[model samples]
Target: MTTEIIDHEEVHAFTIRKEIEIAAPIEIAFEAILDELGADAQMPDGKSLSMKIEPWPGGRWFRDLGNNAGHLWGHVQVIKPPTLLEITGPMPMSYPAVNHVQYRLKANGNETFLTFAHRAMGLIQPEHRDGMPEGWTQWINQIRERAEQKARG
Candidate 1:
């Protein structure tokens, strides 16, 4: 499994691409990625906050990262079960921003290839881009752990 960071000047966006072989079926991997609340909880620096997802197209995907410091409030833009899932939400920073996230899954024998991309729009510091890959790596690793555990049982 490898992780890569891509920076695009045209869109003024930075993307973190993580590829991990989870010891789980594709369907299970997809579910883990779509588990918004669970995923947030597993975030390396996340503090629970308040997360709720409707799990359908045009459904609400909202979270309050406690303390009013950062939050995610948006809707599920696209949902193709066990394959792709996308969500758009407000940025966690002070600047007016929007975040678009996508999860892609591919099945290989008994393993699953999962890739995630998070694009942040608006005023993003150039230096911040450099650290995004690490943050995403941690998140994906957590996802892999959870999915594999589910598969084992």
Candidate 2:
């Protein structure tokens, strides 16, 4: 048996940032985010992912597969309700990588502005790196719809 090594000159790292305006109160928008990212999370194709988030410092963000099995997405690093949430861990990646995710909400009268960022580095595959931007956009759009629907009712 022989050992083989691969050398890379460029580091694999990326940051995705998105800002969305929601036609709802900050509190409502924040709740929408929590709901969307948690049990209500869906793929871009609208299928449930069965995700769960514990919204506090040191809590977990993961997917529940049942039968005492699950995928650990991340841990909550900081949480300030209706304002900010930060998590750090490897999300949905089975390879060597570190990820950080943040959600921030700001209120402007009856409108809410949400800023989201997901940063990761190390051995990221092309599919994940390429798909994240579009996935995040769809998720954000879902959150907006949920919030606006709540506001309308």
Candidate 3:
């Protein structure tokens, strides 16, 4: 339920990592995380975003934020299903550069630990770092909520 921005040695890249203890088992948590990759997943803000995912290495991943915003597009470079997913693409803000995102999951008894790391070299301008923390915080919270709900069921 907390988010912290870690300061790395690279000035051009920023990393945000969050961990949550969900009430669900590892399998349920894993499935919930994977479901979030779909276009119809419900966002934390109660908004439904359309997602298109090929779910394989070198496959494409996209989200429809609606309103003709085009698609937040990226390529899935790694997919270890129920464990890891790596994507390289532009942020929702349509930044002209591509960043890398890695999601790692581990099971601890009845709880599942999830880690998300985003690395954007030179794409996250100095001024943008301040806002990046909050943006990632929200995303992580959403993931935690969804996984917990699925586990409860």
Work out the TM-score per prediction.
Answer: 0.76, 0.93, 0.76
lDDT of 1 by residue, 1-153 (tens): 999885653335666666778999999888777664443554455665456677899987666456764445677898888888888876344455678878888899889998888888766666656777886787688778889988999
Per-residue error (Å), model 3, residue 144: 1.3
TM-score of model number 3: 0.76
Off by over 4 Å in 3: 1-11, 40-45, 65-69, 125-128
Highest lDDT against the true fold, candidate: 2
Candidate-wise lDDT, in order: 0.73, 0.93, 0.73
User: Model 2 Cα displacement at 93 (Å)?
Assistant: 0.8
Q: How many clashing pairs does model 3 include?
A: 2
Query: Candidate 3, residue 97: CA error in Å?
Result: 1.6
